[model samples]
Every structure is written in C-alpha cells, then in structure tokens.
Target: MEGPRASGGRAMTGRSGKGHRDENFPVASKLLRPEHRAPIMAFYRFARVADDIADAADLSPSEKLHKLGELRRGLDGDGAPEAVALARTMAERGIDPIHAHELLDAFTQDVTVRRYADWDSLIGYCRLSAMPVGRFVLDVHGEDRATWPLSDALCAALQVINHLQDCAKDYRALDRIYIPADMLAASGAEAEDLALTAATPALRDAIVATAARTRTLLEVSAPFAGGIRDRRLAAEVAIIQRLAESLTARLLTRDPLSERVHHRTVEAVLLAGGAALGQLFARRRR
Candidate 1:
C-alpha cells in the first residue's frame, strides 16, 4: 500500500510491496548465473514499475497512460529510472527492447480495456502481456527462438493462474475482470459475481473452466524446460512448469474468492527441488 505519491497525494505507483519472492513463481532465483540475474532483475523492475502504474487505483486513465508513455520513452533513452535501468541492461546485453515495448503496450491496454469477450480474446491479450516476458527471458539466456512456443504457453498459463488467484481482489478493488465474459455467461455467472466474498457455484464453474483451459496450456508447455539449451534456465523453467501445474490443479478444486490457493513457502521450495531434480534426470536421459 505504501508507494510514491503525486502532488495531489494520490499514489503514483500502486506497488503492492510484492517483489520477485512474492510472485507465484520464482524470479531470477539462485539457480541462475550471476550475469543473467542482474539483467533479468532489471527487466523485472521495469515491468514491476509499469504494472504498478497501470494498476494504480489513484491514477486516472489519462494519467496512467501518460506514465506508461514515459516508460515507453525510457526504452528509447529517456524516461523513468526503472526504464532507464532496463534500457541500460538491454543495451549492454544486446537484448532487444521489443519485448519491453510489447509489455508497455499491454499495460497501456489495461488502462482502458476492462473485459475480454472470449477465450481467443483473452489469449490475444496474453500474447501482448505474458508472451513477451518469456521471450525476454529467453533472450537474456541467449536461448534459441525455437524455445519460444513452449515459453509462450507457460507464461500465458502463469498469467491466467495469477488472474484466477486474484480474481476476487482484482474485481473488488479495481473493477477489472480478466475472466472472459463469455466464459462467465456459459457458467451462468456474471462479472459482478467476482466481487462476492465467496465464489458462487456458477462463479466456481467459470473459474474451473478457465483452469481447465490453462491446464491445456500447461500441457503444451510441459516440455518447455527440456527444449531449453541453458541448464540453469531450463531448471528454472521446470520449476515454473511444476508450479503452474500445481496451481492449475488447485484452481480446479479450490475457491479463489475465499481459499488460500498459492503455495506456502515450504511447498514452493520442495516443488522447485523436485522439479529441478526431474529436469536433471530427464536431460541426462537424452
């Protein structure tokens, strides 16, 4: 809740005080090489700043758009400190700013777009919002472009999982809904239902249905880690895949509106360990 404020005393960055450790999946964990971690963290901070701006409750749409534009400009050489840091890292690493640009575009869309019409529409948004992140990471590792398909799937699944996990809070606090309107209609649920303290049967059905679709994405990305050439990055991917699978399963059976769906710290650590081992063995088999 505590963040920078504008002259009017409105919060400028809607930072939830969440860092990489607070994410649903690991970010630039110790598994990564030191060189890779710095640039990745820089990219993450840029993203965090942009996301906070877009989600800032106190900022009007115009103000949010303007702030996002500043970040976009930063990519070009002048902007916010976070954006400048990311640009410096990208320049030093020879990583393209295309992904960062795409992410800014997505955040800009968040300023005005409130609902998705269908699954395809939602996936379209993910293409802008989620896929770029994986692509950016792969670029950081200097991994081949061939790895992007699975990465895209995994990233999108993770984004949707986060959406499902925070559905209630997002709806109640921001009045922004990411679940497809059609999906809600099919389940006899309305967007307003998400505001409830507990999910209704119909709302649960919609959330479960979304989880099922996200499960398919997880399936597609199941081999993501195996496709990566970087051992450390591959291991990280495996951990993320495992986490996504577990969360998707939880979404199917748990109520996001009232339940604790995210993994506890110990659970996440164990899952990461097991996934790392599994990836190691699988790679050795080849």
Candidate 2:
C-alpha cells in the first residue's frame, strides 16, 4: 500500500505526469461518500503505477511488459505494492477483481499495440481501459449492472477526451497513439501531424472530427445521471458528465497541439457546481 509511495521518494510537481496522483482528471474526487475513498485511491494508485510502467521511456518494451505482468499477478494475490493494495481493498470492499484485471489488459496492449484499425477497434480498447473505472465505482456503491452501458458511454467519452487532449504528448512522450487510423485516413491526415509544434490543418480537422464522435457518446449517456440509485453518486456522475462535455467542447475549438485544452481549477469548480445545481433541480422535480 505505502510501498509505492515510499520507494519513489520523488515529489510530484504536477507537470511531470510521473504518477497517477499527478493526473489532470478527477478520480476519487470529493464527490464520493467518505467510506468509498480508500478503495478508489488504491485503485487509482495501482492504475497510476501501471501507467508509469508503460510510459517509462527508459525501459525497453520487454522490461515494461514484465513490470505490467507483475501488476497482473497482483490480481491473483501477488504483485507489486500497488497491486497488493488493490487486491486487499477489493477483498475487503467485496469489489470484484475483474475491473482491475481488464485495465491490465489495456496496459498490456499499450506495451505492444500502437495503431488502431477502426473506431470499433479503438472502442474495444476502451471497453478494457476506460470502462472499468466507471464499472468499479458503480460496484463500490452497489449500483446495478444495468447502468453499465450508459456508464460505458460516459467513460469512453472521458477516455477519448483525454486521448485528444494528449495526442501530441502521447506521440512525443509515450510513443503511444489512440486515434483510430481510419479516421485519419478519412481526413487525409496521419498521426505524425500531431508531433509538430502546431497542428497542421489536416491534424486539427481530424481531431475536430473525432471530437464530434466523442460527443455522440455524451449524447447517448444522457440517462446516466438519473440511472444511479444513490443520490450522492448521481450528483457526482452528473458533475463528471458535465466536465467531460465541457472539455469536449473545448477540444472542438482549441489547438491541442500547441494550446492547452484542460480546464483551470476555477473553471472546473464552476462546471462541477453547475452540474450539482442542475442535479438538485432535477431531483426536486422528480
């Protein structure tokens, strides 16, 4: 549990992207009930470590995969500190281990798969990588399985938004690419265009086009806020949905290759607060 935190000894100064705790998007944020935080943080820690392993430019591909394999072993009760913490937390919270395992499946893909053939293929990756976070949270709150499809849409949208924001960084730092190949072909663009200091018209068009696709997921996820059984979780989900859509809107306008697309702290606070107010009104009407 503390092992990962103890061994690194490196302080996260925010831009390093060196740890999961340094992540820009929310995970286990304050919206959840107090009791749920521990398991969520543990899960985030495990995910962060695995991401670190995959993104380690100094490590060879084989070396990175081997570290990821250790994380996989944590599911079976033996792995690194983060994985062990995840296993114990799952057992304690009665949370299923499958979500974490599925994440590993995606991380393993990161070690090998670089190009996506089509939209469906890319979504197949999201089913493993992005969808699990939502599923696990629902499970922690004891929500029904019927909500998963809507949750999947929201989660996948959030995931895609992250990819779009980091397209340039992913290409430069991790040598990873998540944009589907077919979409780029359709736009007469290639992934290399993202590596430039500024996005070419073709690359910007491709991202704008992709943002349209991500928006469809948000549109389909409209029912997610109401589907949750817990009132508190409903509010939190609403806030996240709002944030995702807002960021997506920015994606459609911003030059991600050169300009920042993420919300500042004050902007995010306002967005989340607005979502909370909307949820409150919706609940009162119901």
Candidate 3:
C-alpha cells in the first residue's frame, strides 16, 4: 500500500448532484457501532470526493490529473476541507495513511489508464483499488495478516464484480473498461458488445466465467468470519459474504448488459439479518 498523505484541512463544502455529505459513505449509518461510524463515514467521504474528481465527465485529463495531485497534496496535510477532516478521522482511528494514499493511486490510474492488456494488469489495478480498503477494514478490527490476505481476495473480487456490473456505464461515460482485453478477444467479444440491448452468448459466457472466478475468491476467503473477534464485525463480514453470494447468483441468471441486478432494500435487509443471526447462533453453539 503506497500513496499520498491526507492533509489537515476542513470538511469539503458544497454539494453536487446529491446534496448530502454522507451520501458516499455507503455503510456508515445507525447499523454500525456508534464509535466506528463517524470515522468510517469521514473516510468514505474522502474517498468519494477523490473518485468524483478522477471520474467526472466534465473534467479533461489534465484537469482530473491536476485535481488529483492537489488531493494528494491535501492528504499530506495541506489543509483542504475534505483532507483536513479525513486526516483527523484517520488519526483518531489510527488508520495507516498508506491505504488512503493507495486509493488515490487507484483513482489516478482510472483517470489516466482506460484499458488493461491482460488479467494480470487488471488484478494489479485491483491491488491498488480494492485490496488496501479491505486491509484497512481488518486493521480497524485489529485483525492480522493471516486474515488480511483472504479479506483482500474477497474485496478484490467484489471490485471485479462491480466492474462487471458497471461495464456499460463505465464505457459509455468514463471511457474506461475493466474487462481484460485478452479475455474479450478470446471469447470473440468486443467492447461494443457490452453496449448491446442484450448480451450475446459470448458476452454472457464471459461475464459468467468472470463471476465464477470472483465466487472462487470469495469461497477461499469464507473462513474470515471466524477471525473477527468482535461480534458486530463478524456480522458485517457475514453480511458482505451474503451480498457477494447474491450478486454472483444474479450474474449467473441474468445478462448484465441488459439490466442491472441489485439487492433490493428488503432483500438487503433480509440477507444482512439472516447472516448476522446465523453468525450469532454459531457463536452461541461454540
């Protein structure tokens, strides 16, 4: 994990399309432990802002790169509002700045690089974009490397799944493609095939294969549930695992190109509740 330091600045002002400070903090709500919520929210806000800057359609490559550099400087204590807030939250949580920086590197890469030559290159992007975030979460829960590696695999798999789902939007808007070129070529699919109203058999098959690979990674990392000593944290991991399983199932059933598949609000609640209860029951039996 390597990247820029967060500067000690104030919270970012002004709202974009969604005029909410906490919109980007996906998992930060009453659901999490009160003590952990604020810091995690702040971290998500910081990452979201960085991502927006890198991915904004309005900005030119130079502008995006320049802003990212500024963000990097801010992370180093340059005193921008978001940077300042993130720096404080990170310090309070004792989160290593390296993960924050690594994320910046990932966003920077997104702004500059649009295509990956092979699976290895795509995996390398996952290392910067996804693995560090998982490592940071494990660190917050006081987990060690034994758990970190598997957690990272799961996180990277999640990222890959997300990329697969967002392929259409990413290509049409951001001019980015996370699908490996070689894989597409081998399957006789093209980037243009992703924008089709329905997935061709080749494209469908490619996505299914990719989903299977991600599922394998999740399976390898399944034992992570037992490593979390905190009950809440264990529940969180279980919920994530269930979500991954659900996403994989959906990918197998539907063509990702035609319609996006997602867990509905009720479905999400059911899955999370069921997973948490299952974990609690297992612990009680133990």
Candidate 4:
C-alpha cells in the first residue's frame, strides 16, 4: 500500500519511498549505524521506486517495462536522479552493478509473468528478485562469500513471506499471483480464489501450506545469524529472522482471507531489543 503515486516517467519524487517502514522487517532502519544510511538508502530508493512502478495499478505492462528500463539506464548513467545516485554509490563502494541489475530482471518478469507455475519456478523468481538484496548487503559489509548460500536462503524466504502476505492484494489490484499454481491445485483451490472478498477454507489451507514451506526456508537460513561479521548487521538479521519465523507461524495457521498477520510496534521493539542484547552477550563472549 505504500507504493508510488505515479504510473510512469520521472514524475516520482523522493518523498515516495523516502521513509516507508512497511517492509515488514527492518530495511535501512535505525538499527543500522548512521554511516550506513546513505548508501543503503541510495539502493533502497532505486529499488523501492522501481517496485512502485511495477505495482502501479494504472500503468500498462509496456509502460511499466519502459520505466524499469529507464531505471536500468540510470544505473548505466543516463536516467533518473535516484538511479544516478544508486549508480554513483555502487561505483564508489566498488560494488558490482550486476546486483542491482538482478532486480531489474525481476521487475521485468513482473511485467510479463502474472502467475508462478510451481515452487521451483517461484524460487527461480526469487533468485532474481530476492537473492540480490542479501548479496548487496553482504557486499556492503565486505562479508565473506562463503556466507552467500545462507544469505540467499534467508533473503529468498523473506521474499516468499512478502509475496504471501500481499497475495490477496497482488491478485486483486495488479492481476498478479505469486502463489504457485501447483499448491493451489493441491488444496482444491485456484488463483481466482484470491480475488474473493473472503478466503474460502481450501484457499486458506493452501496459503497455510505455503507459509509452512517458507518457514522451512527460514530454518535452513538461521545459521546466517552467526555468519555475519558486523554485530549490528548480525543483530539486524537476528531480528529479521525472528520476525520472519513469527510471521510464517502466524500465516501457517491463520486464514489469510479474513485477517492480518504481522508484528505490532511493541513486538518489533521487543524483537529488536532481544537481538541487541544478544549481540551484547555475544561480544562479551568474544
């Protein structure tokens, strides 16, 4: 719901994606040190705005694709200010531009692909849409390459969680469905069920099953918490991991059609505090 107001062009203002806290988990939040803000924000601005374009209800598929291409061009040094800033940051940090490019690939896919055929297909989508984010963060911190597999898993899990949370909205508003077709069939459901005002029992069962699958991904990626070198980042990942786990559990048993499933403010504060205290004790051990 925190998407951009425009359908296309350079009409997007910085105010559009400047400080949205709706990422479900912390992204560019205060948990990170101040110095990390600008660069992270630069990347976030480009990605966030691009996401807005892809999700814009008023834009045609061709129109959305064009805006996404413009973003790519900006990264190549000839587009919007947000993309230019992102390009400059990537160059100065010696981070490869390919990571940002990966997101472009996904956005383009969003323009064309409206439904996922199966889990492998969905994960393939995640490789482009999600994995780059974790890779970008790792590159920013200069973390070791060995940690990438776990990071990839965690990021992919987060992506799936987001997809599931917005499943109803995505279907109704954008005519997109990230839920796998196979899973829906298994539950005696179809993609059309998502457009209903209320989720039927079979539809809810399928969604819960998918949530359970996402939870397994989080478990596999849990070790990534210890693998991070930056204490703040580690704490951040810990909080995210915890939040993702909590959200998935809620999704697994709840009816996605009838209610919301998310962490409240006090819950977020507690999770962050737990992560920070965890880092404190971790440092004492070191």
Candidate 5:
C-alpha cells in the first residue's frame, strides 16, 4: 500500500499507490503475450481497488463494506472505472465474473475478519483470496479447466508466502494476523509477539511451522507448469514458483521481523532467468 489517489476526481478510500511492481510476485509480466497481459492488468487494478478499501486504516468496517459494495456494483455493470474496466474485459474475453466476485468475498472478509483460528481456516481464506486470480489468468489464456487444481495449489502457496513475509507489518499496521492462533499457541507464542522489534523464539517457531506447511503446498504444485498447455503462461507460472520457493526458504531461516526476506533485484532476475530457461528446456524435451 502507498499514498492515496483520487478516483475520477473524487476521493475514493485511500487509493494506496501500490502497483503491480510492489507485489510479491509478477503481475501481467512480460512472460505473457500482450493480449493476455491487458486483461490481467485490468483484473489486477480492480483487485487493487478492493484491497485498498479493505486495508484502509482510517475507514470503519461499515464504511469499508459500503465502498466494497459500490465496487461490486461496478463489477456488475457500472461502479468505478477500475471495476468497469475489469467487467468490460471479462465480457470481451467471454470470461465468467465468478472469480472476480470470489475475490470481493475475500475482501469483504478482510473488512471484518482479523485473525485466523487454524491452518484449515487460513487455507479457506486463500481459496477465496488467492485461487481465483490464477484461475482467471488461466481462463484468459483459454487453458484447460482441468489445470485448476494445480493452479490452486500454486496460488495458495504464493498467498501464504505473502502472509509470512508481511506478518509483522500486518500485525502492527492493521491488527490483522494471518498466523493461525493454533500455531501460535502450540509454540507458546501470542499475537503480541509480532509487535516486538524482533520475533521471539516462540514466534520464530510458529513462523517456521507455517513456512513448512507452505512448502508442502508448493510440492503439490510441482507439476503445475508442466501441466499447462500454453507455453507462455507455463513459463510465467514457473518463474512465480521459483520465486515462491526462494521466499519460503528465506522464511524458514530468517526472522521476517528483523531480517530481509524478499529477494534483491539481481537475485530475483537470476532466479527468474534460470526458471525460464529450465521451463523452456523441459517443454522442448516434451
């Protein structure tokens, strides 16, 4: 999230200047064809708008819900430019609006839900918040619907990686903690540990436990890229998988509250390069 932006000349809940680049993974990156990229960016902006509303520190829960409703109406036909744009793209591409509506459901939950009770509950949230984004992209590419289960695994892993990386900031800034209560309790840690300057031993244990679980999700998604029939989209998924793997490994060892968990630009480029070449080679052999 960043500074607010004006929506069509009027103030729309703090617009958080957060762009695709600020995201943990690629968004409409160059890996996909230009036609594919356009609709993806539209969907991303619509999502960003809803996310900004849900995350606005200044807004009350009621206000957030109201604004989210307006965004939803926009998705239906007319609302905000962002929502209208996404709706138009969906219509043009013959894509269903269910995925976008599912995302709105997650954002609506974000307005009211602050803590996750267990791993099952956390994954349930990801089913709404993360899984649809991948499905939407796959739809835009006209990929087989059969590929969704693997895509769901990869997207859920990415979502958890983000939760782990932003744990402390989310706790302090929003009072929202995604680290499941059961995991925290099992490690003798409490939510307050996130407020400290660094992670306590218990907090570290809980985080590592979450990271380990995320790794399992990644393993289940290992066949995802190979399963995709679209070469470009397959390559993009491969790059994202590598990035998720690197970040998950960092979370396992480094304290995100005290240490940098994200990759530096040079390192990310190298990892993406390697993954792209490997994906290309694997496709050639196939």
Candidate 6:
C-alpha cells in the first residue's frame, strides 16, 4: 500500500486534536493577518501537541522521549497526522523543520531535567525552549536576520518572566525550577522559600532582581517593534511589550510569596488599546 500523502489522509490532520488547546493560538491568532491565521493556528497546534506529550505527568521520561522521537520523525515527513499537517504548513511557509525539531528536543530535556544550575544553564534551556518560538513568529511575519536577535531577546525575556511568575506553581507541581539554583543558594534562599505563605525579604529581593533583568531585555528588544513595516505586526509587538511592562510593575508591587500577580482583563484591554495608539503615533512619526 502507498504511504499516506504528507498533506492528505489522516496524517494531514495530525495530533492537534488529541490534547490541550494550543496555548500560542490565542496570541498568534490575534497577531496574525486574517489570511495567515489558519496556517499559524496549525503551526501552534502542532507545537502544542508535542509540548503536551512532553509535559504529561502520567508518562515516564522514557515514554516522553520515545514520543518525542516519533514527533521528530513526523516532522521529517513520516506519515504521523500532526507532523504531516505541520510539515505541510512548513512546506507552504518556508519554515525550517529544524526549529520544530529543536522545540521537541527542548521538551524532551524538560521531561528529563527539573532544575537549572545557573543562569548560563537556564539560558541554554531558553535557547532551545524559547528562542525557537521567536524564530517561528519571525518566520511567520517574513522578518529577516536584522530582526531575529532582537526577537530572540524578547522571547527569552518573556520566557524568563513566565518562570518568575510561575515559580511557585512549577515548583509545587512539576518539581521544575527555572530560577538558577546557584542564585537561590547564594541569596540564602531555599526551595522552601518559594512555598512560604509570605515573601521573605530574600525571596522578594531575588524575584525583583530577576524581573528587573527581564525588563532590561525587553527594553533592548523595544526598537524592533518600530522596525516592522506591517501596522498590525507593530501593534502586536507593542501590545506584548506593554503587557510585559505591566507585569513587571505588578511584580514590583506585589508580595510574590503571598499574592500571585496577574493582569486583570480590563487592564489588558486598556494596555492593548494604548499599544495600538502608540503604534499609530510611531507610524505617523515615520
């Protein structure tokens, strides 16, 4: 029997329907042009399914690794439905399959590893887990090398911010800690500090410092928002930056140990509106 076509049969629909809704879809859907939305959604769905496989707590690390290997084969045009769907999208968009592969490799690492020893180690993880997402987004937007470094900075910073925000939850549930173990040790903080009912001065100081570092990275990437020629793309970048700024501010004000900080719906709407207005002004200036 002939193998299923890479873009046809059950293979074309892929693994997207089997798991959690693609987390990136909501953000990507909002950011992409209407015509581009379907392909972007498909890409996010493919990535999300791979992520779910790696993140499934019920699966042993060996099982996750095996699944990830299958995912990699699928990316290579083997007839796995999700991989086929993803490969078809990549074929149409000129997206590098290497990026998708890198993401799976990262997910596999996460399943096997639980803690980062230092900032360098953490950054190594980001290079695999976070930087590829930025590259994927840039590929979707048809951005070139001139913008990639900045996009990587932004994506890595966002990943770091997410780690800081989810520190407690990830520690409690996954035994994963994105914060450098060395830093925590050096600060005289223990893993137990994250579980405290209130933020101790040491823990609070560490988190605040990390948030500041993320803010610096975000600032470095800010100019790229203005560099994009597409209005909606510019708005998307602006909105993300504004949200980061807002989150950073919230982090600064809240007791991280006692209160989880998150942007409220109304705050998000206003920030997005403000970002759109800022983008309009930027375009007018040019």
Q: What TM-score do all the candidates reach, one by one?
A: 0.94, 0.91, 0.89, 0.91, 0.95, 0.87
Q: Model 4 over residues 1-286: C-alpha lDDT tens digits?
A: 0111122222342223434465677886676777675677788778887877776666778888888888999998999778999999999999999988988898889889989988889999889888888888778888898999988888888888877877887787677777788989999997889978778888987888788889889889988878788877887888878888888988887666677776789987887788768766876787
Off by over 4 Å in 5: 1-12
- Model 4: residues with Cα > 4 Å off, grouped in runs: 1-18
> What would the per-residue lDDT of candidate 6 be over residues 1-286, giving only the tens digit for each residue?
0000011012221232442221211255355598565666666666666666665656667876787787778887884577788888889888887777777778788778988898778878878877777677667778776887887777777777777877776676567778788777767778888777787787777777677777888888888788876677777777877777777777777775578676667777788788879888979987
Give candidate 2 misplaced runs (Cα > 4 Å): 1-21
Q: Report the poorest 10 consecutive residues by lDDT, candidate 1.
A: 1-10
Residue 248 CA displacement from its true place in model 3, Å? 1.1
Which residue pairs does candidate 1 place in steric collision? none
The reply for model 3, stretches above 4 Å from the true place, is 1-26
List, residue by residue over 199-243, the lDDT tens digit for candidate 2.
Answer: 888888888888989999999997898988888888888888898
Q: Cα-based RMSD of the predictions, in order?
A: 3.9, 4.2, 5.1, 3.5, 3.8, 6.9
Error of 1 at 31 (Å): 0.3
For residues 1-286, write the lDDT of model 3, one tens digit per residue.
Answer: 1111111121233123332232211254354577776666566667767777766666777877888787778777884567678777778777888887888899889878999888789889988888887777666666676788777877777787778877777776666778788777778888888778888888887777777778888888787777777778777777777787788888877886787676677888788789889988988998
* Model 6 residue pairs with clashes: 11-81, 14-81, 14-82, 15-82
Highest-scoring model, TM-score: 5
After superposing candidate 1 on the true structure, give the runs of residues whose Cα lies further than 4 Å from its correct spot: 1-14
Estimate the lDDT of model 1.
0.85
Candidate 2, residue 132: how far the Cα is off, in Å: 0.8
TM-score of 3: 0.89
Predicted structure 6: clash tally: 4
1 or 2, which is superior by TM-score? Answer: 1
lDDT of each: 0.85, 0.80, 0.71, 0.78, 0.87, 0.70
Best by lDDT: 5
Worst 10 residues of 4 by lDDT: 1-10
